[model samples]
Target: MKKSMTMMLLLLVAMFCNAQMQDPVKFTAQLKTGNTAEGEIVFSGKIQKGWHVYSTNLGSDGPIEASFHVDKKDGVELVGKLTPRGKEISEMDPMFGMKLRYFEHSVQFVQKVKFTKPTYSIKCYLEFGACNEEMCMPPTQVELNKQGKSPAVDGEAAKEEEAKEEAVAITDTAAVAVTDSAAAAAPAALDTAEVKKLWTPVIDELNDYDQPVSNSLFYIFLAGIVGGLVALFTPCVWPIIPMTVSFFLKRNKSRKKAIREAIIYGVSIVVIYVALGLVVSMLFGASALNALSTNAVFNIAFCLMLVVFAASFFGAFEITLPSSWSNKMDQKSEETSGLLSIFLMAFTLSLVSFSCTGPIIGFLLVAVASEGSIVAPTIGMLGFAIALAVPFALFAMFPTLLKSAPKSGGWMNVLKVTLGFVELAFALKFLSVADLAYGWHILDRETFLALWIALFTLLGLYLLGLFNFPHDDEGRRTNVPQFFLALASLAFAFYMIPGLWGAPLKAVSAFAPPMNTQDFNLYKNEVHPRFTDYEAGMAAARLEGKPVMVDFTGFGCVNCRKMEAAVWTDAKVADLLNQKYVLISLFVDDKTPLPEQIEVTDTDGSKRTLRTVGDKWSYLQRYKFGSNTQPMYILIDNEGKPLTGSRSYDEDISEYMDFLNAGLDAYANR
Candidate 1:
């Protein structure tokens, strides 16, 4: 009962965190001309059911005054009085002691501006507060453009309006010009242009949100083909050919009967694997796809599982079932179980080749799940199983090719060793996740690169027959495949050498530390070129006097790719960010170092250097929040108050606007 209760509670919490609960708020803007020929800007906030927006007219006590600032343009002037549409009365707020006046459903403010020309345009930054009866969010800013045209009065009225326009224009022009200049000048202190430009990849990420679901499905098919090809080379399926052909020949009196049974074997293999996939899809709802990709716990667990599989590949142990299990399955085959016999045979094959296939299956599961679909694993597995099963059936029908198969001795051992290197290399990915989540600086760029170099160096030595393992072949003959694999491993090691010095390494940019996060970066060495660090980024937030966006990401995280490709690309989301946000992206896998003097004693009380950019940010992630996963978006006030309940992503794009708006709402209220 206790276990059940715990499971239920966990399920409920997961549901709440992943909930699509928030509704969007609407606000309207209108433009009008004053006698000055410049436009008078009137902004209105329209709240939905159970929502409220605060008034700007409080005596320095209300939520930050519904403020507006005009971008400076020559000859355009804005002189406006902003008054809230609702009644004014003082109410106490928890954070601020000032008595505040607020509108429950909506509020509108009008500001007056002046223009020297008959027509002019102005961009206004309208910052305001919003709340419901229960909670107030942080303050938010909305950018709006208001345009105006002069009235067309022919005779007597034209001169009078023209005189009024000139008078208002003279008074408003100076104030607008000064405010605009200051706003433009502030970004220079921290390299605003360079930072915003570096963030162009965000636009590409946003575009992914709108991509068709079919494209992902196509990728699933491609992965299936790759899995099938890989299965063809494994020892388990390759050796099965002669045994199957000889068995069919012995059982059937005629050649045609033997061919018919072989076809049934292949058909049975495809059917069993596809059915297994469908069952997996049914058992785990598609919604789990999101959590599987972005949840920190899930990523860590998966990484550990891969490590275990890697050890198995390295010949530490074999994964196998009981001998009686295969005996029982084989007995069913002799009982003429037909399709069931074929499935039993496939199951037997899986068990027989457990050592070789285990690592492959684990790798496939992680890869497909990272695609952000519940069906991904099932599809990947089905593809792989079918591939493994097909060759047996094919070789049964054509017995002559068995003569050409490579005679097994040291060759299989070499293949196993090659796969061992790949398994170990891939295991680092999960460790990267744990490092990002736990704030371990040990896995930073230089450290990660150095480890890969050593791992590959050892692998190269092993391949050249200089280093012999317990299972290695005693004979010395380097085949072309072995030579090629060794060369590739060595070349890859060479490739990573320059990354220690902060090279861009653009060819594998997605997998390497972002250039901005490198400490001694060589390629693009401009200082403060863009939003490189959290302190300067927070400073930008302070200047805007708005909420801050903390984006926790990593170089090795796969789900980060899916989120960037799918959810961040939506047009509504794009507009919201371009207009309202101060975006800060912190790569948790970055290897850049921190200042030598700055250090924090972790919960375990170990003395550790803040060696890498990822280390510091990842530490912040864990200390601030319990989990460390990439594609974590935390919205907070400049004072670091949490907004929008913290968000993570996997597949759903529509919820992105909700997450953004929720943060904006929180800010507007705070």
Candidate 2:
């Protein structure tokens, strides 16, 4: 229950953080004119601190430059390019491989125009990209309007008219304050009910919300096929293949009729399993199942359930549905006539095999449900049913094939035992999730790795016939498959031993807890780049006469870890980063709170408070570079000018080397 509450709290915190990181720039525009037909128009931008707006004349290689357009009027003529009037920061952007100009804090742009008529009105708009230190938003446009009249001819009156014009311009600009008015009218307080609604984190199904349903279905279907194949080797379902096919042959003497009935039986199995999937989907909606995936209570329950299943496979106890259900179906199979009887017989097989297939099916369902797809369960069941039914149908069609099949015996139990070990190992992953979310520190990286190593080692010994379980035969010789599996298991167990000392085991990195969770480490003394504060890194780069490599990373970023393990570990890339550049890794997902909270009005005029270190870095990314994606690598010179094109999550070492060398060359030449 405590873990469950922790999970809910974590999700709510994530949602709140996401909401606060939105719309980093605000804009307002006005027409500045004196008592003349000619006047200048100014566009003012009030950007969030740490965020930046691109200059109108930024190069094509960088982000989209800020630009403006004035609607053509009968007498109004636009005279010069929009000129930025503020502190324009110039830097060579590594992401774009060119120099770019941008503004932080606030900026105003002026455009001179002439009106032929005494009175004129003009409509205009400006387009610009707003970025912070971490990420970039898409370019957006803000519209503006100006209405004016010619000044009086008298000198004193003209001066008064100019004053009036200035006052009217200020009022007109204030009228166009799109952000301020909406912010003012917004509810000052949110009700508890409304807060509850906001607390629900909106999971984007898979990683991409735009992913097609068919793609998800296809992947789950493949998973089902793999599961069915594993289930086929288990003791419960394998032995029945011959017995069921013989019954079909005995009932129908005619070959053609027997084949047709066998196909019907296979189709029946498919329908039954698919129907079961449909029933599950109907009982708990997809959204609920998706939520269950991250629910701490559900994960704990699932972990316990898997433990029970692993014990069952290890011959501790059997998990079975009520005998009445299978008995009723068996009676119907015997009483019903022809096609209906065959279908009932298939249903009976499913029920009788439930003890073994049930665990596998249940495990599969739990895995698929987490994907948040409506049809994934059905598709998965369809695939599993198809794989299970194929052998039964084929053997019935050709009884000769049954004789060629290996006899089911002690080897089947070995397969079960191996799977039992696997299940026990995977159960730890769920526990680790709860541990990480709650900061319980119960199952740290070394402890989890130790448990897995022990489990696989025991499994390998059992496979080699060194130990006997209740179900294992006393004097059976190890078969070829068994020998190889045992060897593989032992090898895998040995491979994980190094991970205890902080080796980034790339293969199992996804399953293991993060490296930082480890209490002890031997690999910490390597000559890696320093991941210090951003300002300090820039200062170091300037003092040392070297470039700076800014790594926009996240603690929770899987790809970032992968890149560190794979590409950055390469000798050349590592050398360049450690020796030639001052590196600073800014973690966008860091949850550490700031010393004091700072509130800023967002681009939409909505208020956002930066209370955490991550929030600050996220704002920095969006404010400076206009990008939010992680594993973003940028190289800059002492003057804070970018040295080369930026790199993202590519694992190709050659490409990374090139990126590093290009930056080094650019810095040297500069």
Candidate 3:
């Protein structure tokens, strides 16, 4: 137990502490002459323990693959491409949710180039991503050349001798991984001083980041409040509203004392949630929260947990904590005299209501964590607790109100069963994210749609008294609420039927599989990007005297598809984008090979090789715009300067329009 605690503490520190940039691989460059004029530049890297560099050609959705850059492309003619020689390790990695090819230990990268003269000068470098189990470092570069005369002809013997001594899998880090997740941006390399000569710091041109201010924290707090309000109506909580009234009313029949105690009870609930928030803060900072949503393992775990919670709601089994735990808290509440006693009572309430509350809490945490805020968990819980406490206080002040409240009975069970169906629906969405990330293709558009259709259709039938679960009343007729819900459910199910044939079910597009996943998408009204290349798009935007909407997206990105289907499809939005702006849709995960490799120097003078179309766009987002996530939309002027702040994956049409209009206003003003 001590060891477990120590390990957990270490993990927490490693995850929560602000980490400094550290380079895991050190590279040494040597020039070998196969007769002075023609030979290879051998770059060797000594990889630190627990870190590995990814190999070339690993898909874009995975870690940034190893590649080389010939900085002085015109200075020397290339004999062939750079080659990695090592014991390459290939495996499925849950971190990035893709198959990865990486080299561990020490790996060697070889670049063969031909010199125009007997004595020549050239420069080149290697780039790769270095990652271990806990975290990933940003893309790192190591210089492989220093301009000078080619060395004399005796290199084969020296090269062979060094090759025998230095052989292991090695590369370095690439800006953690394009996730930039609910994946945190990889830590930058600390060896800034070492690569100073070859690197140029890039910040001078990137106008001070004017990202649109976000009110997401307020929203998260509101969501928590809403969740707490919903919990009060659950089977486990609703029946207690009047019981609380009875207990407070019986307290010496003293209205003043009872109201004070009830107020203390509300404070206790806030304290409990605030304490929970503190624990989350200590364990998970912003980046860790990001990982909770983006990391495949976390998502999969959440998916499975939600499924189990859904089953519990459906009466498959009850979810409960140890009875002793709650009993102990109850005992403490009774034994104590003041605030501690009230707090203990609230704790008991929380424990007792875990079944109904747990699922709702899970949903809230997942949503907020995806937003990647360090304080989200605590703030969210605070909001939830406040909502839960409001009724308790109200009932205490006037104990008669809850006396007329509907009792918990078959109605509560109906509500629980209905929530079960909704939970089941959400479970599939989580599972679908893992499927897309892993390229499993198990839950394609049609498959996902079919499953949802079936689930909702059954839900409608159940609501209409066509069937029942174990806990539900055997023959209860459809009530007003259930009948209306059934109408909505059946209508929703039928609405999705058209989606199977590719009707672009914009209503559920944010939740459904992307149209590209559908084998048969017959929907016709679509907005096509004028250009996929950033530079070309910007150039055209300049020629057309139009502002640009740079859409940093990915093929595997669900939110990207959601925006395209939902927000972008709005008639006004489509018209504005089509007429007012030049749209550049850069797919960060596009694996299409570029015509030829392009070597781009990063601001830090570190070299990056854009080997594929995706690499180029991904690099542009990372370096130029200072972003890496997909479904990122930024409005920029013809000069490549952002007209306003960038917009990400919020599907609020009016807000999105406001964003566009703001950009246009900025453009016109400029």
Candidate 4:
């Protein structure tokens, strides 16, 4: 009996050891060239079929980003940013509250270097993490040789090499063939339909639900049409219409040919604008454009650009294209004959009217790029081109319409000044994006609201003829349209005044900072008492003999915030949460580091090291519940077993109240 027990104990120990050893990812590094003077180091990974690794440039609150660190050496100098080579797969990760890019199957990151010494070795290590559908491995570091060659002999080096070799031998020798029974027990891969469902964009993922891609495109097109109509009243474009049409009418002996050439000119304008959009889309792919929309640096740059354009529109300085270029195009129009001449004239007109049209076009591109769809910019340009072209075509078709058209006067200048105020107001929103992303407290919710209020109030006053700039006419009386616009502007300013307090300005919620940022508040937004730590929350639940509600949330999570404001605030839901359950709101995007390092081996036998608070909660959510999404609400008794099914983002009060009640009933029955 003793001998049999010993043998069984040995077998159990062997199984345990086998379970503890796993290497889902294998990394290899090599020099691009043999010469040591100037070369590139290429780091590549062969990820397991089911796993993926993140890119280096992930968002601030994302998963551990893959990175490389080279120990400082005497003669080696690092160069530009590490460039990743592969098709980067992007998805809106609820944990990060942003789109995350990752790679699967194979991945490569290349870094350039310059070496002055003839023979020098560089010591380097890489840090990365891998995750499958079920679980994630902690960030791992592997030391590699600079030259991608075997390490030189030293006492310490030899000992390390021996240990590594032993580990490798164990892994190789311990490999066991799986039996048919074991293979059958393993989980199946996701089918095509399941994969497709995972990739589908949810309504909550969209930034603008009402104005999704199609609606956004249509609205942008309408804005372009309105802009084109506004441009027709401007000094530069309005005067040229009559001159260009009359020139074609007088120069061409055949009226039919003149009409044909006029239509051609319109078509050329459309082609030029559409080509511009195509070039933009080609130069910057959809991913890049989307990234730029949320990137802090890009937002700052865009804000500055808008400020400059606004100043120019306010008549601080004209934003004309090079006079020489326009002059050259004008000369070409005079020299060429037939269709070519008409096209050149249209090109010249575009260049000459840059001061007026440039701001409008710049604003449109900025707006469309923020939408982050590949086709949005092209569609917007198409609409603007159509609007601009229609007027030229229609005027050519009926030359007599030009006679009854309204003349350009002070109203054009008023339009320009009004647009400047609007530009200035929008510019603050871009600046706010940078501020929020970087946590730069320069522009808070109150500050942004105050600035917008001031700008709009001034705009109303200006429209009422209360103030005049250098370019304004001496008239003090406001016209009927101007009076109405002024009234609307003042009304808008007044509407925002309530937002200074803790009122949720749902209308401007997208542009404004979150309500949590407001310092002084008459109304608080939080529905129930909460704890950020999971263990603490569980302990409290046990002490109170109540169930726990784990809320996986994030600061950047829009839908998470929306649910809190819309559903959790319902009277029934709030009462149950506050009275019955212990709520643990774990922000998966929280950047706070853990006071003490904690590491554990997952059930899959992969070692996971938790470095931050977010890492801890994120792992718990994924590992325990097999989910990585948020505002994920899971109810469990003190033992951490589920009382009811998990609840995700939903605004319906009735459904949410039912979910809470179900959890309560389940807990009571248990």
Give the top-scoring candidate (TM-score). Answer: 3
Write the candidate numbers in order of decreasing TM-score. 3, 4, 2, 1
Candidate 1 TM-score over all chains jointly: 0.51
How many collisions per candidate? Answer: 27, 24, 23, 0
lDDT of 4 by residue, 563-583 (tens): 676556545677888988999
For lDDT, candidate 3 versus 4, the one ahead is 3
Per-candidate TM-score against the hidden true structure? 0.51, 0.58, 0.71, 0.59
Task: State each model's CA lDDT, in order.
Answer: 0.55, 0.67, 0.69, 0.67
Off by over 4 Å in 1: 1-215, 513-519, 525-670
Judged by lDDT, which candidate is best? 3
Sorted by lDDT (best first), the order is 3, 2, 4, 1
Model 2 worst lDDT window (10 residues): 8-17
Distance (Å) between predicted and true CA of 39, model 1? 39
CA-only RMSD, every prediction: 20.3, 17.2, 10.3, 16.0
Q: Which stretches of candidate 2 lie over 4 Å from their true place?
A: 1-219, 525-670
lDDT of 3 by residue, 1-670 (tens): 0000010011110011111235578777776655455767787878887567778877667665777776574346788777889999776543345677788888987888775643456666676666554344445556655444443433454345334533222333233222211012111322233222112213233345454445566666777787788788998988777776577668647789989998888888888877877687678877687776656678788788878988998999989899999999999989997778878988999899898988888777776676556787888899899999988998898777776877777978887787778777767777876777677788988899999999999999999999889988777888898899899889889988988887766556556655667778776667889988765676577678999988877655545665676677666788899999999898775667766666655545455566666766666566555555556777877666766656665666667788899989989999
- The alpha-carbon lDDT assigned to residue 641 of candidate 4 equals 73
